[model samples]
Target: MASRSVLGDIRRDLEAYVGSKIRLRANKGRKKIVEREGVLEGTYPNIFTVRLSEADSVRRVSYSYADLLTETVELVVCTASGKETKFEAHSR
Candidate 1:
């Protein structure tokens, strides 16, 4: 199947309301194991800005995988020695 641009869509959606408030999920840490809900501060083509609810700190997150799939997404966390660690996603 052809991969759709999911990340691109997110960017466009965010652009529609540049200064408005919105809810977003962000992954913290290099492993992306920690997820948190926060307010959407800004959005770029493949990047999103958020102020973390916990620490009230602003952070940038890349959403380049949005176009991968409609219901599922995958992230490659590591690849070494012919082994790989990936994150599988199911979106509503």
Candidate 2:
């Protein structure tokens, strides 16, 4: 199980990337994976939101920091200079 401090760390790291473009890769169980590109909207105490542009619709989604700690969700932040940085949460 992930520890409390680790989740806190993940939350802090994500907070720094708010308003940046991000690529989200989520594991939906049973060999299913969903990917989307969006902008980090806000970071709250337990979760953060993202604004995404889908096939003709704009959607907002939120996920918990625990999701990153458990490896269920992966976030890749895209910088303006064409660099991609992957966000990771490690339990210690």
Model 2: per-residue lDDT, tens digit, 1-92? 66778878888888899999999999999999999999999998889999999899999999999888888999999999999999988887
**Where's the lowest-lDDT run of ten residues in candidate 2?**
1-10
Q: How many residue pairs clash in each candidate?
A: 6, 0
What TM-score goes with each of the models? 0.39, 0.92
Best lDDT goes to which candidate? 2
RMSD of each: 12.3, 1.1
lDDT of 1 by residue, 1-92 (tens): 32335455545655544444333433444755444444446766555555545675566444544532332223333222535333343333
C-alpha lDDT score of every prediction, in listed order: 0.45, 0.91
Name the lDDT value of residue 39 in candidate 1.
45
Name the lDDT of candidate 2: 0.91
TM-score of 2: 0.92
Clashes of 2: 0
